[model samples]
Target: MSTAASEPEETTVKQADQTETPLESLASICTVLAIGLFVMTFIFQNYKIPSGSMEKTLLIGDHVLVDRTSFAPPTKWAPFVHYRDIHRGDVIVFYKPNPETPDLFLVKRAIGIPGDRIHLVNGIVYLNGVAQNEPQAGKPVEDGNPQHAFDAYRDDFPSVPPPPYEIQPLGITASWALDLPNHIQNGDLVVPPGMVFAMGDNRTESEDGRYWGFVPRQNIVGRPLFVYWSFETSADQMSKTSLGDRLSFIGHILVHFFDETRWRRTFHIIR
Candidate 1:
């Protein structure tokens, strides 16, 4: 009877070990999955451009790696510590209107901070009543200009004749139906205490704060540190790669593969 009882006890112990093996495996998997999700949420993230609104500075099809912890504190564990403060002219990424698509990120330059009065005169941008001198504004190119020849051609050859031109008769000046410059005159649209005004470099084509209003500080994700990679949208048009073109590609590729990249724009401290 004693030998029979010991056999049953040993069998029970073996069954418990078999059950514990799966439990241990499950625990390991859960731990790994949790860690992966946490890292993805807080450490770094990737964003893809969806529009030409920030053209010349950013373009469609360009994928950027955004450092999510650049400005905000890492998680809630340490609340008092801030990584960095937002500055004027910093190219920042932010959340868009759609809730279903969280990956839709918009990149724009921070123009107005709290308490700033932004305005526009004619075609120039002004901050706090003073006209901002942006040396980077490459030759005031019109929207859908010669560069976008395809769009121009499509517009000109629409299936239906466009609507009749409306004349908004001003006392001395007659306003015909034509594209107008998006300029703000006098408006006390004060950027709330914890909000900012953002604008794309492609002023004419951008749907920015000028359209949808200010961006809350909480919406900002991160500042773009460097251009890890860049491919010219116009490169494919070339017939054959010249020595100069080959050199350019080699340099760009090297930057793309190795270094902080953006050879010409590398180490270019964001102002």
Candidate 2:
């Protein structure tokens, strides 16, 4: 037994400390915040429906998650991301193409794309000389119903020019009223290059492209992916911007969060 030759066995394995320093923790938090900010600003957006224009599909008080990248212009940096031309029948969110109200954002279905010929007959949309079968489009009330009145300006579109502002100031922007005639050719409204003809699912209720004008390709924000949440909110609630009203509504939401929430509409995908 050569005890002198047997040297003390060396212990090479040691436990490493895993606790994070304050600076490391701060860096992690900053990284997360940066990613979130990028996502919210350029990849996805949150929008709350303020009107019933896209009703049945998107109701007032329905908060939706919009995909901002799908319709965005393609870039050299993000080759893996999907980017496609806006197709007819796609539900789109865009800015109102009105000189007076340039910042108003609206959601409507794409009825016509560039170079497409569009017209309407009896509230039915005809695109590119072919009538589209859209089950999502709403119909007017039956004859004798109070809401059964028809407006040739809306249902017929371009055939009867937008009414005089003095007669009806709510629908049809001033600029559109002036420029509409230039686009009407052979009884069809020809969508110019880089323009989209958009309409609401509720044809009678939606003050869409027919009222304002074509949604410029550059003005499109994105398409709603799904309804993240929905509440029983009135259309006028958006106009109640007073501080007292805001606080009252916040209290009302706290008390009625469970009951007033439209649970069935939660996470409902927008078509």
Candidate 3:
């Protein structure tokens, strides 16, 4: 009688330890996925560096994760979260602030904030009458190399009025060309309220604020936090928009993923 009683208790324990049913497992997976989707949609987002505008700092194919909460407006729901206004020198991702490219997003470093006076001399940024020491900023070497030769209009900035759009080598938009003059005061470009002056680290290659216009505060997105992954990619690869080209690139990535990946840049923090 005692042995039989013990056997029934062992059977009960085994039944209780049985694995979850298929439906239960599926539900668990869905719950996890929903949480992950929420986090990615609201808290963090990822962006890829498609151009060399921010070269040396952010290379082409560098995939970075951006924190969306830092520069976002305060909300009572998440009062505990820390939020702050964008500061000078912060790398920002924002809409191009151009009617022609309304949907385009560009990444650049904030050089001027509201009320700040800005100018450039020989490609060096002069913020509020003092030359900023920006070690990351890149300019073409003055070795008479025509391809990398300096441009007086780009290097000198507002000091040299942008040439007519028809003959302009620099990518200065016509609207910006007209509006840029209104902001200049005593040779300094005064940033108006709710506007930011931004430029790429690679000054020679970037078509940034000098080319377009001030980034509206409303158009400002969050700053990048770190490079999650990077792979060797061509500068013009992003221009190929065909379905076949995208699929071909996907195949190439799969084949060369291990070898082509920039392992050193993985998880590299963005300043």
Candidate 4:
């Protein structure tokens, strides 16, 4: 009788070890998913390229994973965490202040830091009184007139745009441009403390520091880690306002995902 009872007890123990309760299984799944979501929303973020503002380097429909921890200073309790400085030429994502939009995030290259003298001569960027060697400046955009081709407000930094077209400066840039003369020293714009001068890799097409003024240190987001996905969709498709257009774009993506996807760009590291 004792031996028979022990056999049944052993069988029950094995059964309990082999099968998980429904609640236990669900809890495990929830834990895994919660961790994944936390990592996605906090440590890294997914960003879609809406325009060619960062062309060549970051094209339209290119999805990037921005690393949030790189620029985050370590806490005293979390001193073991890896942290690095935001160096020049780093591609960073940040919140650019815009009254129209609530959360306007933009990606650009960091050109100058606090105390760095930044200026542009005929569109070539000079940092600390020296010309920057940026091979990724992209192709020059053609703006109709050959004479004024290199005379946009972007081309001649630290100086107001030539007469007649001088009224183009807007908002914060306009305010900064008004006081730009005070900051200019020997033709270079000295970056104020706690601010950074940022621009886009596609210099000709980018509406960056040249138009907007310096980016504050607090506005600096983390760097772009890699291009996770790249699609051939146009910029217009990104803002599919109508329901039909949105559904159609979704169907198109599902049908032509392989053909329209840029396979080479997937997992490409951003410099």
Candidate 5:
């Protein structure tokens, strides 16, 4: 009968509605976000290739889906192997070089393990006194000639010229790079404990441990599982005419919109 009594009922209804709305909204949002995070973290993680370091094996612009759980704890049915036992030839992704500027990730093949002695002779990789049989090595190549020549020149003529410039340009040539009595001798470089040597399949183009030093085992993220998708950019994607060719700069961009190689490399396996 009193108007005040009706006011209390309305207030109670309003409080109940407010509480129910937030709970319902929160539950819905949490369910969707949980599923998305789980899919991205455990099932599949996406990666984009930034360089040709692993060319022919993994091309630029290739989008790969790494199985996060592949090396993780095995299922109850199969529990023998673990991620700790990483073997050679595994394509692994790890934190990029330069700890201060650590955003981009790198992918390379495991070449040498802890306690392994690695040396290069005439562009051939000898591991532990045995020539490694690299079925996937595209072509054998070598670097570090200038360093060797400079060292030799310093030993012979310690007072002539200086540290680096003393070595002549011809000394850096591949044919004459290791031309010393002890040049072909094997230099035993033991792999430091808990470190692994990684090299790219495209040996000539890779800046790996052979240049920058060994990759500590902690930096390793996971092994590459599969190539999920690939997008190939056509030659026209770049400026076709540099004021000399037939096509105009604007014309090339217009043509490239339709000239993209969309399906040539999709779903290809990362060998």
Candidate 6:
């Protein structure tokens, strides 16, 4: 009986059966990276809260999905996108002006829009010379401090005097002091075009526009669409970036992911 002849592997069959050529491997990686970059650069991006600056609205460890296109300008290369202007009371995510903390993105309320006049007294905000109808600002907090219950700059806007509380921080609040006369008209801080005056929901604890300066139109990344996940982590733990601390945090997440998750906060919209 003649044995069946051994089949010789064809060159085409070998090429097709190869896991992938070097170029193809690179192509696959590039495709994945490109998609990720595109999503991060244009459509959506993630942000995490490391502090209680935004408090009840956005607590520490609240992971948010920010819609980058929400404020994206019309582009010639892309489709005709009708992006709306930023609105007052909208919660926005932006890069903190402090260059030292480049990765520190802060979440705050868009209290004053372009060309709007803003005034705050004892943490009570006034918009366009009228008391703002702010449900978020009025949001009750659990702060127990009675004295200095509001904030330091309660009486020092429009004509931001040398900060009475201490050496004025070299921030927007300081700039306002230098450009005091120009920025003030009728005793209200007039938000210049392409700049917004931002504040935190937990006004007393936040170091926002009242401490620093305006959030430049470009620094406004996007408004958070919703809280995708919220883990019960403290500000101290969230702020620690050491290797040991990070590993510990990761271990904690792995062990208590389900137990620590703020299930009620998931999908909670950011105003």
TM-score of each: 0.55, 0.90, 0.93, 0.87, 0.60, 0.80
lDDT of 4 by residue, 40-122 (tens): 87689999888777877899999999998878767786576788877888898988844455378999988988888887877
Give residue 217's error in model 2 in angstroms.
0.3
**Number of the top candidate by TM-score?**
3
* Pairs of colliding residues, candidate 3: none
**Stronger candidate by lDDT (3 vs 5):** 3
- Candidate 1 clashes between residue pairs 3 or more apart in a chain or in different chains: none
Candidate 3's error at 198, in angstroms? 0.6
> What is the C-alpha lDDT profile of model 2 across 27-139, one tens digit per residue?
99999999999999999999989988887788999999999999999999999999998998899988888767789878899989999999998888888788889887876
**Clashes per model (N, Cα, C within 3 A):** 0, 0, 0, 0, 0, 2
Consecutive 10-residue window with the lowest summed lDDT within model 4: 162-171
Which candidate would rank higher by lDDT, 2 or 3?
3
- The lowest-lDDT stretch of 10 consecutive residues in candidate 1 is 171-180
Q: Which structure among the candidates has the greatest lDDT?
A: 3
Q: Ranking under TM-score, best-scoring first?
A: 3, 2, 4, 6, 5, 1
Identify the superior model by TM-score, candidate 5 or candidate 6.
6
In model 5, the runs with Cα more than 4 Å from the true position are 1-29, 70-84, 140-186, 234-264
Q: What does candidate 5 score on TM? A: 0.60
Query: What's the lDDT of the predicted structure labeled candidate 5?
Result: 0.62
lDDT score, candidate 6, position 140: 31
The residue pairs found clashing in candidate 2 are none
Give the candidates in order of lDDT, highest first: 3, 2, 4, 6, 5, 1
**Model 3, poorest ten-residue lDDT window?**
139-148
Candidate 1 lDDT, 73-157, residue by residue in tens: 5667866556876787888988753345455568888988887776554435667767788764332344658543322211211
Candidate 4 matches the true fold with a TM-score of: 0.87
lDDT of 5 by residue, 141-231 (tens): 2355433222322222111222232445422222222322222224555676887877787665565655445677777777766666666
In order, the Cα lDDT scores of the candidates are 0.60, 0.86, 0.91, 0.79, 0.62, 0.76
